[model samples]
Target: MHEGTALPGWTEMLVLAPLEWMELVGERLCVATCATVAYGAPSLGTPRPPAGMDYVRAYVLDSADTRELRALVEARIAGLADATGARELAGLTVRFRRLPPEDYASSWEKVWKPFRAGPFAVLRPSDRRALRATDVELRLEPGAVFGTGRHATTRLCLALLATRVARGERVLDAGTGTGLLAVAACKLGAGRALGFDIDPAAAPHALHLATQNGCADRTEWRTGGFEVLDAADAEFDGVLANIYSDILQAHAHELCERLRVGGWFVFSGVPDDHALATRAAFDAAGLRVETERTRGRWHAFAGRKPA
Candidate 1:
């Protein structure tokens, strides 16, 4: 479930979930999703040295009904032991990709132009302005990470954030890749906003956007993994995590813990096929789905902790 070095056979997990799971596992855990029968290493990153005969882990769930689910999952694996369709094999196994850390660099930019949304103004560094239902002000910019206002996921998140970010509401952007969501929350009337990202490039880019959006004081940025999220102590009126699927499921617990009662959590960056699984995980975490928005194959779900 965790590792002390860069994981091996991580890319194969991409078969089971979207690319985001690797991000969610943070600096721990190797990847081997249901999509793959055998494990592999991440294609990127400088893989760390092997753990020396410390074999990776494999787990099998014993729920009565889950046997079917496991069978359904294992059937999708690329290779397998004579499965004989054994549902008992329904579980995950990650093989350490005996390597060093690889690098993941996001190529994004800011767009500074006159954009209008309702009576408000925005900078449309992303194509998100095109999806606007009402005229709002915005500026565009290049970013380190992709998917700001221009991406469907980000746009959907903005639409939902607009409705809930009342004046003085505290906001958090869990995977603040570009800090766009946090800035949007601030512009939408949130009292304050903070962002965190696993990638080091995230903070500076996000801070720059915050300053450009005139929310320098309203938005704060941090560097660290989800574990660094402990700084939040169940604070935040709204949270946004526009990450891929596997990581989303892995962090479902931390996300629930970080949200305040009656607060909202917006999740995006999921592929269409994984929406139900993602929703199921959120429900299992005790968060209530208040709104659902989808564009193309991506879905943005808004949920809340019980008030």
Candidate 2:
């Protein structure tokens, strides 16, 4: 799709496969469609798949070449069975449907309702819902990036930040998707917060979010990875990281070094399967794990840097 061009509609393609093959199928779909892929059940509102089977969905620009796309997807699926020797993959099928013309940009707003995360009430920029007297308001426009406060990892990090962020503290948010954590820290009374992500598109979205939340002056968004922090001094009072377990483990020492002595940190987005290994990495970096939280298959850790 061209930049800024209005989409007429979308051709939605769904591939049905078993649970174990969903990820591989989703990857192949992305390659075939040259777009992002999502995994879920066949039902609209259902979050998980039925028993062992799941659906992988992708969208292509509505055009006359849909049949070609379907053929390519089928070929990819067939190749998967040959590559993995999993003959069951050969049974997978790709279904296509043409969606009506509508504004796909704002369509998500119809289903993304406001929700509370710890002391903060997370809402869309256009939501007009009334807030309670004690509610700390956070306005977000969930673009292509992550950290919408709906994900369990984000909520867990927010809950931990609510308890740990002290007034006038300097905060660092690594892998700051929509700058939700950094902006939230500023809202929670932190003096300054700096957030960065490897995705080049992340900074603009995050800056807009900070401006919407009235914390742009106190928050800074940058485009890069942890190396962006290397030019600065090690003076952050708190750190927030909601990223993959492998990335967290790889940068544990670097993250710990950025904090001041006895400073606090919140680390989340680690699946339960990697919880023990992640904990070992944190401990190896000299962080004292003070609290551990789990929701579903995810885990979050809150702790402090030792003197």
Off by over 4 Å in 1: 1-134, 231-233
| Residues 94-189, model 2: lDDT tens digits | 777887776765665466668898999999888898899989899988666766578778999998999899999999999999899999999999
What's model 2's lDDT at 60?
Answer: 76
TM-score quality measure for candidate 1? 0.59
State TM-scores per candidate: 0.59, 0.78
Cα error, candidate 1, residue 174 (Å)? 1.0
Q: Pick the candidate with the highest lDDT.
A: 2
Q: How would you encode candidate 1's per-residue C-alpha lDDT over 95-160 as one tens digit per residue?
A: 222222332122112122343332434555444535445554445465435434555677777777
| Candidate 2 global TM-score | 0.78
| Candidate 1 RMSD to the correct structure | 12.5
Give the lDDT of residue 67 in candidate 1: 39
**Which structure among the candidates has the greatest TM-score?**
2
